[model samples]
Structures are given as structure tokens and as C-alpha cells.
Target: MRDSEMTTCAPTLLELQWAVRRDVLGLADGAASEYVVPDGLAPQARLAIYRNTANSTLLTALRLTYPAVQALVGSEFFEGATRRFIGQCPPLSAHLDSYGGSFPDFLAQMPEAASLAYLTDTARLEWVVNQVLHAPDGKPLDLRRLEQLADADIETVRFLPSPAARVLESCFPVDVIWHAVLSRDDSALAGINLDADPVWLYVHRGTSGVAVDRITEEQCRFTAALLAGRPLHDALVDGPDAGTSVWLAHLLASGCFVDVCLSSQASRRATGRQVA
Candidate 1:
């Protein structure tokens, strides 16, 4: 068929499918072979190189983000595990930072990694650390503004947490596992129970790099509620039964909540009048 006639006939669905497969999966076929320039190498060899390069680049990114997890699994084992992971779950975003969010869940199900039961939780902790480091920064809420509200109005005061704050919970002693891998300090690992109930962790950026700390259940619930835009009184109500005053004071001191908003329409109207 003439070139013009072929074009007018409309490209076959098979031709379109091949193009998409080549672009997305880096697949090699007769159509794709036409574009490749073989330099003293077989076409299959060249295509194999492309496959290796693609897998290696993604593996390197996962390694950088989860160095502690890599160390725990050893280089060879980690590479094999990551290869399986990448095959099952290719990156979903252009940003590599968000690439490994599902790695913990992936590790949890891998039978080969079953011996290191804590590995999955460790991966989760590392992912959370990365997320907290990249979270946005914001100013601490003004305590003086909080004081201006009447006792009845206090319950209507909604909280906004700093974008940098993150919470992580794990059944394994993930904090201990993280420190052990990163710091080469085993002291934190002592007395760690892999089967214990999940421990809650909070991470935030302070003056230095990201600071990670264990948090009480009450604090976890309170901060989680606040992060979800809950009002102060409602947050406390949802939190564990403890001293509300002390928990609020600690949250303020930690610079966790960034701002307060009016949860009630009445408060909004009152504040609008004051602004006017």
C-alpha cells in the first residue's frame, strides 16, 4: 500500500498498542527495533541493557530513601526484594520522594522477608520520616489569640497543625529498629518486643533536622484529631482520658498546631464583627 493510503486507512489498533507498550514498559518489538541503533551489539542485548538500567535507576531511588531498611536486609537481599517490589508496583508519580509509600505493606507480605518480622515496620518508620522531612512549614498558633476566646467559645476553636508534623504507629519497635540501623546504636534495641502492641511515634522538624519522639496515646489521638481539623475541645474528647490542660500545654510547647479557626458559624460571625 502507498504511504498516503496507509495513513488514510487509520493506524491499526495493534500498532497503537505496540507504541504504548514500548513507551510505558520499554518493550522491544519489530516496530520498536526500527528506532534502535545497534552498535556492535545484538538487539536483544541492547534491550536487556535498557531493562537493567530502568530497574537499577528505580532501585537506587528506593535505596536512598530507605537506607536503614537496605542495611537491615543486606545488599544482595535488598536488591532482590526491591526488584520483585518494582516489578509488582512501578512508580506511580513523577516524584521519587513519594515512590515508596507502599513498600512497608509490600515487605509485610513477602514470605522471603518473614524472618525479619520487624523489617516491614522499619520500612514504614523510614517512609514516615521522609514524609515529615518534606512536609510544609508553618507558623505556630498564637496562644494569645486562644486566650481571647470566652469559655463557651473555646469548644468551637478548630486547630491546624504544622504541615511538618507526622504520626507513625507500628507493632514492632520501629523507633528502636530505625535508630539501630541509622545510628549503629543497639542500646535502643534492647528489650524491644516485636510482638508488642503498636507504639505511636511523632516526627517534626525543629531547629535541627527532623526530630522523632515517642508520643503518649492521648497525644496521638489529640494531634491526629487536630490534624484532621477538629476543634480543640472535640479533639480532647476524642483523645485518651488524661489531663486536657496538660496535653494542650504540651501540644502548644511542641509547636504542633499552626493556627486556630472557628468551627462554629456563631464564632465566625463574632470574629467578623471584631475584624470590621
Candidate 2:
């Protein structure tokens, strides 16, 4: 077994560490006094200091990832929810950015946020933006090379989506909510119609930085298939429900695709990248 996977701490020390974790999360305590060394502070007091630091650190991480969600629901409320969320789903990754992906789901299930149906979707959108912002830059596909492909070869071409590309669909107009909350437009937030058709959106890194786009359902379907590494012919097999060429141009122009390869050569190609 890998050293990390093996028990490195002595039994008592490991038990105390686990106890400290439970204490930090406000879970059942493991009699910290027995494990901790005698110091100026009592064991529980020392544990309390750690608890404060842990909660504060995790809270900061959540705020950074879900700023819009925090803005929508006031900071006080957000902090309370985050505390409960931490108790339930503690940090799993050393990187804080990877820690709160499940926070949207946690909020969705919260009784306090039950009235705000759009809250979950808004948080989900924020998570996507956070992810895209942190993802590695991808080499944009050369459209000229695509033009060089013969008609038969074009159909068999498989496009690789940018690493930062993501799609989201929500019954609520989450894009509007995101913009309004981030911009602190109380008027826009107040004017939102909760009962609207689902909006399909894509989050991707643009020429400038992370950006979101409002796309049609047909466009969503087409782009989703391509994002899953489907070939051109298969991605269009069903219905675009709109002009194929137009949607294709829009997605390509939007930096959704990063590289291209022949469907026959996909398995043979070891990596998703294409070298110049």
C-alpha cells in the first residue's frame, strides 16, 4: 500500500487527531483531555481555538466559490448553512476550490432555502464559473485546418471541447439571477419571474476570461454531445431544431472546441491535445 494510505500515526495520536476533527465539526467529542498534552489551555479550550480557525477557513473557501449564492442569501444565513454543510460534508481535498461542489445540493435540501427554488441553480452556476476560472487553458482549434478537411473527413471529425467548457440547464433563469446578484441589482432581482422556461447555458473561458452564454436547447444538446467527445456526424444525427451551420459557427467562435481529430483515429491518438 502507498505510505499515504497506510497508518502513519501512532494509535493514540491517530485517535486524538480523529477526535480533534469531530470536535472541529461540532460532532460528538472523543474525550480530548485524554489525548492532548497538558498545556496552558485546557484541552477543550485548545480544541475550541482549532474549531474557530477551521470554520473560518472553510467559510472563506465557500464564500469565494459561491459569492453570488452568499450575496443572494445574506452572509449571516450563508455562514450558518455553510457551518451545517461542513459538519455533514467536510473538506475532502487539500485544495479548497474542490471542496464545495456539493454545497448547491446541501442548500437545495435546506429547509431555510426551500422557498427559494432558484437558489440551488444559482449556486450551481457559480460553481461552474469557479471551475472554469481554475481550469487549465486549452489550445484553441485552428479553424483553417478544419476548412482543409475534405467533405468525407469532416463528417468523421471528432472535436475536443475546451477543458473549461461546461453546460447547465435550469427551470429558473439562473443566468439572470447570477448577474443580478453579482452586480447587486436589487431591481433586477425583484423583477425576476420565477415561472419561466428552462434556460440552457454554457460556461467557458473566453478571449478575456471566464464567461457565460445563453444558448438554445438545441444548441445545448449539440454542444453537450460534442463536449462528450462525439464526432460531428453523430452529434448532428438527431435534431438541432435550428440551423446547423449557424449553431456550429457560434460554438466554435465561442471557444467551446479546443482540438479536432478523426473518429477513426480517436482511439489511436493517446491524448486529447493536438500539436502544431
Candidate 3:
């Protein structure tokens, strides 16, 4: 073949794949033109199958990640919403399960979803649950080891959520709504007054598997601060209502922190005190 013909025939694999992806995601109109089809072969129809399959896969993944949202909005509405969502926010990574990390934010921006203001928070809850389920396993922080430290040492150290732990705060009753929908308890759903108080949630892997607990606002604040890599002392400053001794005991018992970060000097001090 001539040089020009060779060039025309040999589009890079990446270029073709990107064109197909754009078409599947509805970002472009003429992806099928990238391919040469023989007589009697309908390229548009062939591409449509791939597009439909992509949409179906995305819908299934979304439903799995946000089952509560799907149940709350009903199948038809959820499907329609997801169709739009996938178009606007196509998967950035090949990992399908991690695809909808921004789905809650996307739902928040939708006009139809606005009436159900809690929907976004619900999505957030589901996403967190999904993430916690997949997080790595680790030994929780040892409470006994923590107790040997002095108050000043404790203050200077930072706490980390166990690989299993995730904290989320919502202005809506996200935990209640999630449980009600999943359990198919209509009465429970009915009793949830939308005007009711906001909620703080701690989703983590428990002894029995994944568990979601409703924690206090102070606990949520403290947890958020810790997750942001703040020292325990600084984290406690935001919420005076979070009693230091009480929460320390509760969090330690809850197995929330997988590891504690004590400075090199503090670690030596703690070790020496233990030896003494």
C-alpha cells in the first residue's frame, strides 16, 4: 500500500479505543466512522450494541454501589438518572467498582434529584460503605498500649482510622434511610421524618463483617479531624461536647484506629516507661 493509504489504514489502537469510548459515552457522534466496514455490515448498529452494553454494565455497577438510592428512587427513575450520570461522568479508571465515587455529587447537581435532598447524602453513605468493604485488613490500635503513654504523649500523637473505618456526616438521616430501604421495612421508612436531625455515621468492618453505626456529632467531628491527619489534641478542640476521656475510651474500644503515630522521641519515651 502507498504511504498515504498505509497511514489511513493504520490508526493507532489507542486512538480507535478512545474514539469508541467517546461514542459509547455519548461524548462524540461519529466514532463508527473510525472503522471500515464491508458491504451489508451496519457499523452504526454494531456500535450501538457496544454502547448499550457499556450502559448496562455501568447501571449494574451503580445499582450495586447505591442499592439504597436505587430502592429509594425506584428502578425507573434510578435508571434514568444513572443514564445521565454515566454520560456526564464516564469512568476514569478501568476499575468499574470504583467508578461512582462522584455519583453523590452528581446527584446533588440534578434538578430532579433536588426534591429528594437526602438522596445525595444517601449516595455518599452507600459509597462509603462500598469503600469500607474493600479497604485492607489490619490489626486495630491496641488500647492497652495506648494507656501506657503520658497525657502529653497522647496529645502529640495522631490517630488513624483502621483500614476498615470510614466516617461520614450528613445533614440528613442517611443511616436511617439506608437501613430502612435495605431491610425493606416500610414502617421504618415512614417513621423517618425528613425534618429530623442530621446524622454522623461510622461505617467499618466489624467482627461480623461490615457494620454502620450512628455516632454523635462530636464523634464525627473528631473522626473527621483524625482522618484529616490532625493530632488527637487538635482534633478534640473543635468539639468541646466530645468528652475527651469518654471518647478516648469509646474509640479505643471500637477498634477504630489501626495504628497510632507517636513521634520518634515520644515512642522512645513510651517504650522506656513500659520497660520501667
Considering TM-score, which of the candidate structures 1 and 2 is the better prediction for this target?
2
Query: Could you tell me which residue pairs clash in candidate 3?
Result: none
Candidate 3 per-residue lDDT, tens place, 161-258, comes to 67778899888888899999999999999999888888888888878888888888878787778776677777777776737659767767777787
lDDT of 2 by residue, 156-252 (tens): 8999888889999999999999998889999998999989889999899987988888988988888888998888888888654559779888888
- Cα lDDT of model 3 overall? 0.83
Which has the greatest lDDT?
2
Q: Rank the candidates by lDDT, best first.
A: 2, 3, 1
Give Cα-based local distance difference scores for all models.
Answer: 0.77, 0.85, 0.83
* Candidate 1 lDDT trough over 10 residues, lowest sum: 27-36
Clashes of each: 0, 0, 0
Best by TM-score: 3
Who is ahead in lDDT, 1 or 2? 2
After the best TM-score superposition of candidate 1, give how far the Cα of residue 156 lies from its true spot, in angstroms.
2.6
TM-score of candidate 2 versus the correct structure, residues matched by position? 0.83
